[model samples]
Target: MSGRKLRQLKEAMATILDDLNRGDLFSIVVFSEKVEVWDPALGEAEMQDNLGRLRDWTESTTDAERSGTPAPSVITAITLENTNKAKRFVQNLTTYSATNIHGALMKALQILEVGRSASPEQTNHAEERPEPMIIFLTDGQANVGVSDTFRIVSSVTAANAGNSSIFSLALGNGADFPFLKKLSLRNSGFARKIYEASDTALQLTDFYRQVASPLLANVTFRYQPDQVEPQSVTRLAFRRFFSGSELVVAGRLHGNNVTGEVQAHSSSGSARYPFDPVILPTTPTANTMERLWAYLTIQQLLEDDDASTSPGKQRALELALTYSFVTPLTSLVVVRPDNETRPVEPEEASFAAADRSRAPSHVSPVSLSSFPVQGAAKTSHNAYSRILPGGYQDMRPISSSGAYYADLILPAYPVSTSASLDDILWLSPNDTTVSLPTGVNGTSEVLNLATADETNAAYAACVTPGGQPGHCRHLKYCVLLTFLNNQTEFLPFFCRIDSFVGVCCQDDS
Candidate 1:
């Protein structure tokens, strides 16, 4: 990757970190001749003592300020907010001699595997399988090493299933879109092409934050009657961001009692489920109208029009105008048609042209007084047992610290394995005053607090935190609430490891 493109990736990643919930994890793997692991970013730290525990290590160590900074580029711009956490978790990314994409995909899966196995606390905390993801951004095709493109593609597709969604972004004109699309589509993901380098950063950023943030995971639609299919009602697409994202499902309704159920599982074992089934009322109001015009507007933008193409484009425009004019609700129930083979006009065909053009922004007014609303009743009486673990447990093999960079091994393929940085530092977060790892300081290099750290905190805070015997977030899982020096809690935030800041800041991406 060029310096310009690398910087662009960093900037785009920063945009996503700030918007993510604390529990989500995002990994960015940059594959050239080597591989790198960029970990999750940190939220704001809480206030603590001025002379932090790590101050002792700095006493013997010469201040970079006093010793003169290494170089102008030594201090990477800490511009992104939650990057502090990510920098600490990921360290010492490896460098290689060849750009092997197949190798990179395998390495990404390994990192996730290691993360999953690293902590019993994490495993215990998670309600379901971690929704892992791999956003592979490459500018060229597989040119070096094992170059069997078909086998490479098939292997990657099979590897990515269930565990992660692989989104491949092809940068510059050199990228092969057909190949990239095949790889992404095969693995329940998609491929996007950047027209040029200028468009790379923003698109990459959008793909990370907007598309990745709202996870519409476990999306399934069920409908009966061959005449009324839900898939035909509205076209549906799913995008996965960090961890928790809303599933947007909008489509034309073809019958009365139209029901739509959407459910998402949180880090807590609890499930956030929403079910909608409403009768198709005949009386239409301003609030009852659907915004089908927006869909039509998208269709218009997708068309190619010229002087000779005037008539065809005009017909599309006219239909859009009619749809906007009538402001049709999604409901389009038809028991039986007068003619079976007649091409059905869009629900918008019932409107006038002038009214369509004069239409106001679609806004609905819902009156709660007339509609019945239901609330979720509590099934259990006890809140404490429902949320927090009832016991206190301490971590074993207390101290573990070292810095060694080596290749990450993928269990399935030895040839595809590559090196990555894994730094496991330890820290203790007690009530009132929290302490970082002995030598760790700042957000860039974090002291890897083990699963023990998370487990200990759960015991200290929930099971034995003074008078109130209650859970932290209240959902049946051990919650690791890392209180920064400032007394603020930092939830898990996700970011690319290549952009990760730390002591051994190798060019991972």
Candidate 2:
């Protein structure tokens, strides 16, 4: 082998492991000067002394034989059905010289064809096939082969028109776009140019997440009359996918009034599966559809360009991550005060003030929203008062700190209406359930009690707040416990209270 890019290839291998561990399967073939499978096949060893077998396989193979056919020897050794074995086989192999990308794809396609022979036997039951997927990386153009790049790409594309998906990533400089783009489109694959080798793993991970465990396999989209045309929706695609041993498919209802259904057929059983006709009235625009569109577009671009500069790749990433609606980064969001049930609005001025305080001595203060958390207090005053909204703590007054019991006011909430201290087995209330608990205006010494039912839990105030050695609340306090499906091992539950105790200033006037 000649012209092997060891470091870049290792980075690619690491990414394959990370993605496959998460249930995404992809084959990697890197091309530089020549091509070789990152993973090689090994015959069963008769004895431990057979370490010589690997060395002989590595050092003795001639370049002509190794690169002889468009299909590398690896094709005969790996198939979709034996993919797991292929994985183990690759793990034990070493990197080889040359990065012949087209050669690598040719080898991979040959490997995949073998799947048709060894594919798992399908029963009358719902059938599924291992998702057909391929990923290719290259830093140079097609130089060592007698085959024209365009012809190879066209053939691969025509083959993929029926099944399998291909995605390509080009790293550093020397990428060939004309060849890459055709290859990507032929198989519905993507090609991207990465400016640096470092970004390969991250880019690969993103690619895998977008296509892995497809919700619908062998899936396609079609349009109906009177419904909006499919092309009008800029980024119509699957937002999330669920996987089993069967086929995967996901969809969104187009326009608010538009109606349609998602259908899938298991390759094994040839069973037609259908999801509810998704209907939407609101017309989707490019900006709104960018995320889903990003997945496919990024795939195509990565296959075509080698734009791996930090800022350049970042722009690609922002697009890719946005469209990857299935990943966690696209899922979680923190609630703002206005959007949540918090009473106090977040102060904008405080954010600016905090930023100014942290600015460098010689530099003007940059406005910021909050100070960073450290072991010591950044502000002199009341820093300890910061509390988690809707959170509870076992609070006690400190005499050494000169803290005094003051009126603690908890607002009336849903818990007051439904939970009584006795119902939760909290502190024992007078044991009488109140028809209606007293609201803020109606004041009485007795706290109204409520009962827990089948869905809700019984809450009673435990004299001990800790549920162990015990603590206390001065106000009429109680404990509440909820039983989910009647299974109780003391799961943490929330409580709401109305009455609070506080210290008031004696009127000198």
Candidate 3:
């Protein structure tokens, strides 16, 4: 996470600490290259006086000067008064090099295990067993020890042993969302992506509140075999259902009818709930259920093993193709008209390839030139018109293998037909202004064109309608103009073309 994002995370953590209830048992485990837990001294506190001392210690450790210092510890239980200590711990968190995801999970599982093993006198057992959960937050890929997704999942499974659930929060664009989603799904938890924008803290806090509430645990579902057989169900049972959470089961119908009753077991074998028998349409035109089933099956396949060569992956690709659903394995191809003869440049080719690999299959690429130019109606007064010579043109044809459509246009400058070399005024560096020289006739008057500041301002005005600055367009045009003005041979090539016409279009057409 960036420094600003880290601060937002701290604020979110503080909110969580503030909302913690009296009976709630919590632990703060912050990790980067290493894992750090609150001081053991804070955990040993039995009286209200010790709580004050714990808070003081936390505040001292979180001092700005001490932010760079690293501490080595594991986990500390949070009490009523120690909430401040937890908040302090979160506030002091600083960015560290390398992400040790495996280490973090292992440490969290170990802490939960210790909590479960605590004596009855130390932890009340008659009320209920505290649901052990780890809220894993990360903004980058794992680069430290045991970085493999499968290896990390295996380690988490062994350490967790069905005792703890991992709720993952992927922060920013750099986060590996798919990997985190798989990790959470395997552990019977939830996963969410936190975009890089304002109100991230609110989003984090809202997500925390949802995961904090557990309506049910250790849920299992059973369907009638004669009516419908469970071809594929959500791997992680609905172990932790929140207030607004929905439980959906997708399976294939055995006969022509889709009628079955579902039996649900919850609370670690203590309670049972039976759902009403479902009656689906027999001759429905739209196969909504089948499509839903395919989606769930694909998710399970991806969660199980995402290796391209794996059988599960192959099956997922086949299912996606059969259902006409876009998947990571497939790329959408667009056919252009025969008259469009624009060639794909090297930069555009690279851009298309990268975009295709990352973007979701359903979303098509949009042409950059297709976007309307701001203040285009008044091109004469518009500063951007002077900077971008060609203005807007159709994008080059995209490669079929590329993911999204390639829509970037190479920079082109306008060639002047009426204006001669002498008509262009040189900008004086001392005064930072442009002035046209007097005509051959003595009666002709000099005219000022623009100031250096205005020319510089034109660079920012050259932007796409979507509000993206056209830095490449401005830079390339500037370079071409400078070359034409300085080199005598290039002057002949540019002289014959009209000032309003693009050199690239003239040569290509």
Candidate 4:
């Protein structure tokens, strides 16, 4: 993972830490080769010492981390002091070893179990309290302990006695979205892929806000038997309900009307939102209700991945197509219904292949471009635009082949001192340079530098919209171009490349 992403992760943690109040009880579990519960109260020096012990334990060099001396496990009650400590802890974290996803989750669940058993509110069923939540963050697949995806899923399910919600944040392209989604779906949560970009921290913090406030816990909706089709109901049971969001319970009623009740445990006490019997037709927008049910059904079915749900997936696809909705099962397609496809316009590039008028320079007699026989009608080479990976390149129609693209030729002439430059670099079609030897006292030789370098942190960056590695290069050399004003839409940096103001971009579009 990039250091940029790691910094954003730290920022997100800081945001969450700052947002929490005294009511929140939190513990962090990060695992790679071994599992460890992070103590928010520990100072940086102490934490690093403990971390060293944990590392040695992983390597079998020491038993200090695993032995009878139970490592400090401080399930922190949110306070300004604890929050600052936690932020420091998060800031110092570094990615290491192979991911131990199973171990990490099990460790988190164990922490939650400890917290639950120790809490007075948990013991009192009537007392409303914050439901246990596990915000699992990882960048890549589990490659260490209990790596088998299915095995890990089953083991986690078995270990999670509290049925604590696991919101999985997949931080980059290396993550397995399907696996995370499956795990979360099985454990009363969901998965979100945080794309690596400029606003990565915002994405993380925004997601945290959605799950931060627990308005109700153990939420469920119930209706009288025969009033609504039981199988048709859309996720009646929920782990928790958050503030500023509707907990929709959708189902197809057997008749026109039905009575139901929403049962939940809120912050105050046991709560029941009971509904009285009413005619379904009292709702004027009948189609709206049907659409809502269809929407919910599509969402639920698409999320389910059980092999038996193949038919359900198909039904979801049908509903998505019928309703013109984009879902996992369906993609949004743009069709040119009128066959009104825009034709690519043609363009041309002309070069004086050989400097016909050279100032005191003797050169080769041959030229890449031939001059029209004096007085003969000038034959024009119309360069039809060829769609390229980087962009359009000039192409001219040849009799033999359908069309032929030309090699990029820049302004150059065979000089007296050397027939060729010390560097004869063949530039790309998008390139606008040619290497040559130095001239008079004031002149200088040409230089061709690489697009990116790890040594120069300022020059190294991801310039592509999709977050692929790229670096700043001259507009003429950089095939893919984006507006300088629209820097926020793409990568992090731009720089100078020789005489040109460089834009960060890869060689390809």
Instruction: State TM-scores per candidate.
Output: 0.41, 0.40, 0.57, 0.60
lDDT of 4 at 108: 72
lDDT of 2 by residue, 218-260 (tens): 3433334454434323223322222411111112223333333
Task: Give, for candidate 1, the lowest lDDT window spanning 10 residues.
Answer: 365-374
Model 3, span 250-321: residue lDDT tens = 555455443223334343546765444424234344343455456556756876785669999988877766
Q: How many residue pairs clash in model 1? A: 28
Candidate number that wins on TM-score, 1 or 4 = 4
Write down the TM-score for model 2.
0.40
- Model 4: weakest 10-residue lDDT segment is 362-371
Kindly give the stretch of ten consecutive residues in candidate 2 with the minimal lDDT sum: 435-444
RMSD per candidate (Å) reads 25.3, 21.1, 20.4, 21.6
Model 1 over residues 131-248: C-alpha lDDT tens digits? 5667788777775544576777777767654546677777665667667777776676666654343334545664564344433454443333432444333323333423322222
Count of residue pairs whose backbone atoms collide, per candidate: 28, 67, 4, 0
Model 2 segments beyond 4 Å from truth? 1-5, 18-99, 119-127, 146-148, 158-162, 197-199, 222-224, 228-256, 266-509
Best by lDDT: 4
